[model samples]
Target: MSPLVQPRLINGPYDDPGLILDFRHARRAILFDLGDNHALSARELTRVSHVFVSHAHMDHFGGFDRLLRLSLHRDGPLSLSGPPGFIERVEHRIRSYTWNLLDERSADCVLAVAEFDGTALIRAARFPARRAFAREDATPPDLRPGLVHDEAALFIASAALDHGIPSLAFRLQERMRVNVHRDGLAALGLPVGPWLNVAKAAVREGAADDTPIVIGEASIPLGRIREHALAVGPGQSVAYVVDALGSPANEAAILDLARNADQIFIEAAFLDEDRDIAAARRHLTAGQAGRLARRAGVRRMTPLHHSPRYLDRPDALRLEAEAAFGSEP
Candidate 1:
């Protein structure tokens, strides 16, 4: 089965911390942080539907302007979720820019921002290009706690950790995976088209087997397709975490957020020998990151956000993380 999301690191471990999750079935993407993202193309940033920021640190959110600039002329809304006080920060950033040239004829795109306080969004707002990106109060959606974004297809869960401040960790959970059999479609004389998306949604939404799926001029029962052409499988999830102190509270939060995730991108900012420095900076060591991912039961882990101190020995971080990941916590 084809995976729905393709997660990739936005920059080298020592540069900035971020992830770009490219969607496989649609022209959409989700950004896990807005750090220096020169690595991502303008087209890629324009397709980003939402951004989940870990914190307000420069290394985590300095690239906001690039994303905003790329989104200005787009035809779709750009949504963003971040830790407390983030809504104001977004507004301030927009305010710092001159919007005198912006008008209704400019674009219909809106910048929807939400501030999540660890558990759930505390406030939300909308800034439309038509209104010159002015801040307007909006009601937060009714969603379960810890869920920053929720939709029928997937949901984003977050857990805030201590880093001298709240640094959030996120898990992108795809609701379900739907696989289609090309051979079965050919045998049934059905041509490949957009109807497959409808069928996949039906399966994801648990539509009744007898539900009639209209494809072209003919209506087909979902059960027949379920048996001959389609299959349902477990969904995939990717987790992102950075800059959190290595403490029991943070560990518990990360473990819960990343539990059984297919892959986890975590920060390993220091070596075990630099434990004192890491603790002073509220960062994690390579060993700590590995053990945390292991305890979370993730299938694979990518150690990132390496401090420049080990630039001469890049492999040291990877080796330390791998060794700890393979051992018991």
Candidate 2:
């Protein structure tokens, strides 16, 4: 079955770290970090509907200008969530640039920015390019801890980890996976079309079994479609973690947030031999990252954010992580 989310790294380990989650079931996409995003095409950039920023570090947020520029003419709103003080940082970033050419006639470059205070959303605001990106106070979502984005197919949960300051790690939790039974559809004399989406929505929304699904001509009961044409199963999850300290608290939080994830994009910032430096910088060593991934029981771990100190031995860091991943948890 085709997975709902297709996650790709924005840059290599030698560059800034980020992840882009493209929805196979939806037209839009979500971004994990606002790092250097030049790797994405303009079309793909415009498809991004949401962005989750871990922190305001230059490497993690310096690409905001590119995203903003690409989405200026797009009609859809661009929503971003991050740790506390995020709204102000985004405002300042926009304020620094002049918007003299913008006017009421221009396409709306709306940004809905929300700030999660490591628990709940404490602040939110809307910024429109036509208004010179001025801050307009907006209502915050009363979300529970570790949850920021909720939708029909999935909900995004975040954990705030310490790296001198709060660096967030996010997990995309899919509510359920429904696969179409080709044989059953053929038996039911159903043509492949947009009606399948309606059926899937009915399944995801838990609509009544007696609900009617409109085909080209006949209206069939949802219960018949569910029993014959749809196969329901467990959904997949993807986690993104970076710039977190290798402390016990962080380990616990990361392991929980990334637990049983199908894929985890984590930072292996340093080699095991340079663990002292990693501790000093509040970053993870390759071995530490691997062990944590193993303990989390993630199916796959893609390590990024390698330190330049090991430029001469790029393979050594990943090799160490591989070894540790195979070691006893």
- The model with the greatest TM-score is 1
Whole-model lDDT, model 1: 0.91
Q: In model 2, which regions exceed 4 Å deviation?
A: 191-195, 206-208, 214-218, 327-329
- Candidate 1 Cα errors over 4 Å, as ranges: 327-329
lDDT for position 240 in model 2: 91
Tell me the deviation in Å of residue 274 in model 1: 1.5
Per-residue C-alpha lDDT of model 2 across residues 51-162, encoded as one tens digit per residue = 9999999989999999999878887589999999899999998998888888898788799999986677888999987887788999988876769888778889998999
Worst 10 residues of 2 by lDDT: 320-329
Q: State the lDDT of candidate 1 residue by residue for 1-329, as single tens digits.
A: 77888999999888999999999878999999999999999989888999999999999999999998988888768999999989988988999999998888987889999988888889999999888998899998878998999987789999999999999899999989998999998888888999998998999989999999999899999988888899789889999999999999999999999999999999999999999999999999999999999999999999999999999998788789878899432
The per-prediction tally of clashing pairs is 0, 0
Q: What TM-score, to 2 decimals, does candidate 2 have?
A: 0.94
